[model samples]
Target: MKKLVTLVLFLFILTSTNVVAFANSTPKIPVLLYHVVTQNPSGTYQFSLTDFKNDMAYLKKNGYTPLSLNQYYNILNGTVTAPSRPVLLTFDDSTSDFYTNVYPVLKQYNFKATQFAVTDWLDTNGHLTRAQLQMLSANGIDIANHTIKHQPLTSDWNTQYSAINNANIKLKSITNNAANSVAYPYGNYNSTTMSVLKNLGCQGGFTVSGGLSSSNSNKYELPRIIMANGDSVSVFARKLTTGY
Candidate 1:
């Protein structure tokens, strides 16, 4: 009886240790957000193409893997495991610079990214065209919703529904890919936002809130750190390591 009890205790300890190890091994992802990649410092949200390239190089050299929105969703849903030091690189606004500047750099790095497109603005003045979006989708870049007119979803329920639904429809019409994930415009949303998104078949949403993303994080309120203009390599490194 004594021997049996000792073996049972040993087995319990081993099981507990494995569970703790598995928990500790879970990846904490940092979703890095950018608006435009350009040479001109157009605004606080626009990053220079050089800086963006350096950031990507740093990520590659430091062993960071960029994951698409769909892969991140699967991670959250426990359908897949995250890669080593996974990060989600998200570009918002579907700016023309994405095709002219960002796409080439991403292709060079052999990396994937998610783009949150404001459907109504596409092919207008300096935004992406339907053809560009279709090519992007075909190239494995996940194009997500940023609403129809970049409207904040904290307004009335009907307005929110219209904006999101309209954008999703236009996105699918152009790219033949459903907008299953979204990034809230200006990172603004309300309590009703999650329910509405779920009703629309959205599996996840992103906010401008800065932090590390985890599998246990709220699916509709995931945090992202905005990459700003003139952020040095060290700052970018810190953002990746510490999620500032």
Candidate 2:
């Protein structure tokens, strides 16, 4: 991990884009937020499988390396280094479509990804089953937390804490590992949420806004670029490099 991070720092220095994002005090990572990848898509969160494939292929062709959440944690918390084109592919919601459509393509490219799951939804009708989550966990996909029941975490401390607390327990039970991070449901959170996460010893708390993340970023409020269905391959590429 140290070696990987060192190489990233070397690359980060060589290709530092001062024009993009906040000034480079630390290496910044583009964390992508994706929802369901589907053949027939709907909603602002839905992304077509074809476009998804194109996005993945573009990354491969252009030399982007995707990292799991743990790998990313090591990089950011340790050396603040990054591969020249490093990006974290994060999928919100463990839809069955991820197992059926997405995981295979990610493997084809030998890429790593993190899935933020709503613990209660696992084994439900449309969500990934516990067995499938286990499979994903064992297969290099980092299974993390979305929340207990996809509830809207607000200023209410108990509601926010319970949502995160309950889900971590369920995730640990199913995946054999407690979540190292959590993406607040619907990308909503507050200082109370951060306090709960800190008390729970969570490593990172992801949000929906903010363009990119770095060592200088708030560990409890990292941002991700939301990938919507209407976004084309060009838009996806721009989002990673330019963060607009």
Candidate 3:
């Protein structure tokens, strides 16, 4: 009887401590990473316009706020206040489909998104044109750097640095605004690469790693969850709630 009583008391104290810790913890915001928005395309990297619209609608109805890339940076750096339900929607690659397919839906729902464009591929592979980039910025879409040639920073430092610099220059020419954020190509980066990025004025850089952002996370090197191509509406909803 005495042993049982001691065990129960210990368990109760542990449970109480856990509850206190959870109560004092801050909620983590989910950052959805998207690549291409297409018209019912069949691929792993493409989401239909309708599906995109549905996702936006879900956010709207759920009282979640869509954050721009800069806004996310502010949160990481402790410069801006975070909303109760905050989400950062990021589209990778500066594909023309983003302007034609994604932007319209975002505008329809009055939601903002961040686009990380490949400077070298802007005019190729149906990517966004220079004119469209300016228009996107004017319409409340943030333009970020995805590197000049979308090469891995850890593979070849010289080439990667040149590409990043070129992309920054091109993005500035298009939007006339300072671009300070980058998403690593192929989700590759090293300590040396991160050091170079820090020197280049990037407040934060994203990777393909999976996790939530917090005060302890490195602002220059952040992890992002992948949204596989052609994910169903149900799966997408689950992704939002579960932070996968």
Predicted structure 1: lDDT: 0.89
Report the lDDT tens digits of candidate 1 across residue range 154-200: 98888998999899999999989898888999999988888889898
lDDT (Cα) of model 3: 0.80
Please name the candidate that would achieve the greatest lDDT relative to the true structure.
1
- The C-alpha lDDT values of all candidates are 0.89, 0.87, 0.80
Better of 1 and 2 by TM-score: 1
**Model 2 poorest ten-residue lDDT run:** 17-26
Residues 1-244, candidate 3, lDDT per residue (tens digit)? 9999999999999987865554345356567888877776677867777777788888898898888777766665455677757788888989889888888889988888889999889878689988899999988998988998888887566766787778888899889987788888888888877876877887788887766776566876677767876677788777777766
Candidate 3 regions off by >4 Å? 1-26
| Alpha-carbon TM-score of each model against the true structure | 0.89, 0.87, 0.84
Write model 2 residue lDDT over 114-170, tens digit each, in one string. Answer: 999988888899999999999999999999989988987785888888888889998
Sorting all predicted structures by TM-score, with the top scorer first, yields 1, 2, 3
